[model samples]
Target: MRIAATLRMALRALRRNKMRSMLTALGIIIGVGAVIAMVGIGNGAKSQVEAQIASLGQNVVLVFAGNWSSGGVRSGWGGAGTMTVDDALAISREVPGVINVSPEVRDRQQIQANGLNWNTQILGEGPDYLDIREWPLQDGAMFTDQDVRGTTKVCIVGKTIVTQLFPNEGPVGKSLRIRDIPFKVLGVLSPKGLSVMGSDQDDVVIIPYTSEMKRVSKRTNLSSISVQSSSPEFSDIVQRGISDLLRQRHRLGANRDDDFTIRGQQEIADAATATTRIMTVLLGAIASVSLIVGGIGIMNIMLVSVTERTREIGIRMAVGAHGRDILLQFLIEAITLSSLGGVIGIVLGVGSAKLLSAIAGWPTLVSVTSVVLAFLFSAAVGVFFGFYPARKASNLDPIDALRYE
Candidate 1:
């Protein structure tokens, strides 16, 4: 009951100076709101990066055929087809951590269906290519191993091809002609949006590598190979295993450089995530500075409040009130101010996050963890800043206080 009375008196004091109370809490409100909004944006960016990574493939590693060299004059990477179909098979069969290996030969060729012609990337892909790339079918079935061995004139296409050629119908079981040679469309791949390189991922046609060698590229070697591990944790092991195996297969001496290049998706993800994490921490740190400023504002206002209430303190002490009661009353007032600001800030922050997403086309995720931390910090600010003034009010010389103006 005594505590309740103290709270009532504290609230009444705030009510008597509504404008002053609100002004005092403005800094806290802004601080909490800014912190929440910034963190939301940071998380959103991180999520976008993760989604892009998943879209590319999970636990994927790419190996490009070596650069061409003549008399120590070397061309850029992927300039020569040094990696072969046998190399991909060896990695898949002999490597410990490798789960899937999809060898590929690439060409940019014109495709025609019903005389609707479109130029797209033509890939000579292994049977496990779809599995390795995590490219699902929107319709029909993937070409089989039997198709690859037979060098069947069969193909799978992506959404961009479908949109370009089969506008009103499905491309499955249809004929898409490449290089004046007709091939049956085995499937339509799911929409994959854009690749990390900003190219449309769905703008492609896939055929068996044997068929590509026989009919399209007339090349005996693979252009590249993508390897996938069972899990991300094993990617490094798989990469190392691949490197050692390839070096041996190519019969490279210790002094000679590797002909092929291997790149891991996990490496890309780690770099991107690390950059974003640093930015998030930096932004959140900047936002936290406002919270410190808010604490200072609270301290300043509380000191003024103590000075204004000195006469009241004197009267309460004269009327049998204990020092603890005076301290509790002031402390309760500061806490109420900060906590109320926090609540209002939460609403403001969430609203701002949604608005940013809608207006700016930037992703924003307002996590519960961020919200909880903000609220707790506000409470701490209240307690830390409110303590000194409340203590001074409690320890006042009541007779001197009563005699003052």
Candidate 2:
């Protein structure tokens, strides 16, 4: 028989048992849908984490002012102010590929403005801090280098500060009191939603590090330093240069650990995204088990079909249908069922992802690659599980098959 006739016969056979065929395809449909939905959720989470990491700005590196270890005591970074203003200046002056640097100090204070008082984070940073962070001013201008040098009482405010402290008035050109000392608001920072640590990014005020050390916080040492490289390719070089310069300046010997820790943008991003990547793979693996179960269902159903049609197979073989033709007919039926299921499952999966995103407020991203892979895998499952039953039907002796009924 011709290939076309065999395919037609196979399809016709399936149509004769529409309820059974539909029930058999359900397993594949559920399997494909689950895989796509789980993978989409995973990819969405990874993308969100990467976006947050990118918000730290391009080619950025951080220098935290604390030691990782002190003779095996193992005190991690950010314990105390081990870095100085002079250290930040030396990095900007001496380090190659370093384009921008910001000495940092951190504190929390109840700031008052416009007869409204709110407790927010206070940051001591350089004039180049916004530039290094790639953060733009929503209103007015950034405090200049002169402000840092003069230890001026000028400040920048985040959106949350504006909302809390200067709700009815323009924050720029306004005065906000930090630690009972008033500072002129120079600019309003563009709103940043949240940090990777899930803290509000915009609930802060920024002032010159000089003013922070000399006036408000009254500390000589810095909390940390933020650095920006000239380009992405130069980030590693800049990081290395800063490490070496700081080590030499601090006079740490080869056997002794440094007093500061340095982290580049790529390293931070990798660390942040590692959890999401693992979740993606784990979800995908769990969902794949359903596809295996679906394939088994197809195998079991095909074996039953071959048994029920054993006499029919004998009649066909006796008439002149080749064994290969018999095999092709059964194989086509299985493929038709699985391929049809795959197509429907693709639709179901995409719909489920969108629905989840809309209703549950979850981030979901369905990639074309995933859809294509699911479809192809489903079709391959048909071939793999369909072959045995097809081969058994084709190999039956016509005389014995005819006598069995």
Candidate 3:
């Protein structure tokens, strides 16, 4: 009965000062809202980064030409001095963990089909390139080994190339000219969206590696070689095996350093993930400061409230209310104010997350854990800030409080 009476008195006091009560609650509202928004944004960014990494393909390794520096500052691009077709073949024959290998030479040139012309990247690779990269054909077949060996004038186009050059007709058996050199279209790749590096995967043309090296670019050196591992677990082993083979094939002396780099898909994914996570944490920490400021505001307002309600406290005490009863009354009011704010903030946070995901076309996952954490933290702030003021009100001398003007 005493508890019920105290609660009734607390509610009545809040009702008497409607504007003050609302203003006090607003601090908690902003605090909880900020926390929810920050966490949601962080989670959304993480999901986007992971999705982009997954799109590259699983259990894949990319080996490029040029030397890399382990210490001091170096240029962004690094590779062996030269990677030849023979190097790719040797890796395939000698590397135990390598499942498949595809040597490639790339050049950006203007390609024309009929009267339509557009600039696109041209990649020269064997049939195994499509199989190893998991690139599916939309139409026609991939080039055969015979096509590469004979340097056949056959090409495979990406979905973007097909859409740009052959809008009305299928690309299969069509002839596209790359710098006045005509090549028969053997296949077209399905759309594979843009890579994390901002390069369009479906905006290029692919031809037999031999054809591009000998007939198109006429270069003797390979740009890069892509190798697929049998399993994700064997990726490291395959990477090291390829590195050792390249060192041996290149004939690097014992005291001399290697002039090549072997990179695994897992390493790229890890670096991307780590960078994204750090960015998210940094942003979230900055946003959390807003919550702290809001908490301080709550504490300031609650202190003013206790001073303003001193006479009320004296009246309740004179009417047989104990110090504990007064303490419970104020604490309950504080908790109610904070709890209401938490609910409103949760609704706002969820709505904002959904809106961002829809607008940006990125993935956002709002977990139950985030909602619970926000709510709990808001309540904790109320309790922490409300305690001092509540204690002061409870400790007030009834006679002195009542006599105050």
Q: Write the per-residue lDDT of candidate 2 for residues 82-108, one digit (tens) a residue.
A: 689899999999999988999999989
Q: How big is the positional error of residue 181 in model 2, measured in Å on the Cα after superposition?
A: 0.9
Candidate 3: regions farther than 4 A off:
1-16, 68-79, 94-96, 273-279, 311-329, 356-367, 394-405
* Worst 10 contiguous positions by lDDT, candidate 1: 267-276
lDDT of 1 by residue, 293-376 (tens): 988888899899999878988998898778888889889888888887888887888889899999999999999999999999
Over 4 Å off in model 1, which ranges? Answer: 1-9, 66-74, 316-328, 391-395
Q: Which consecutive 10 residues in model 3 have the weakest lDDT in total?
A: 73-82
Quantify all predictions' global Cα lDDT against the true fold.
Answer: 0.88, 0.90, 0.81
Tell me each candidate's TM-score: 0.89, 0.94, 0.83
Q: Which order, best to worst by lDDT? A: 2, 1, 3
What would the TM-score be for candidate 2 when compared with the true structure? 0.94
lDDT comparing candidate 3 with the true structure: 0.81
Q: Looking at model 2, which ten-residue stretch has the lowest summed lDDT? A: 67-76
lDDT of 3 by residue, 148-184 (tens): 9999999999999988999999989989998889999
Q: What is the lDDT of residue 237 in candidate 3?
A: 88
Clashing pairs for predicted structure model 2, backbone only: none
Backbone clash total, candidate 3: 5
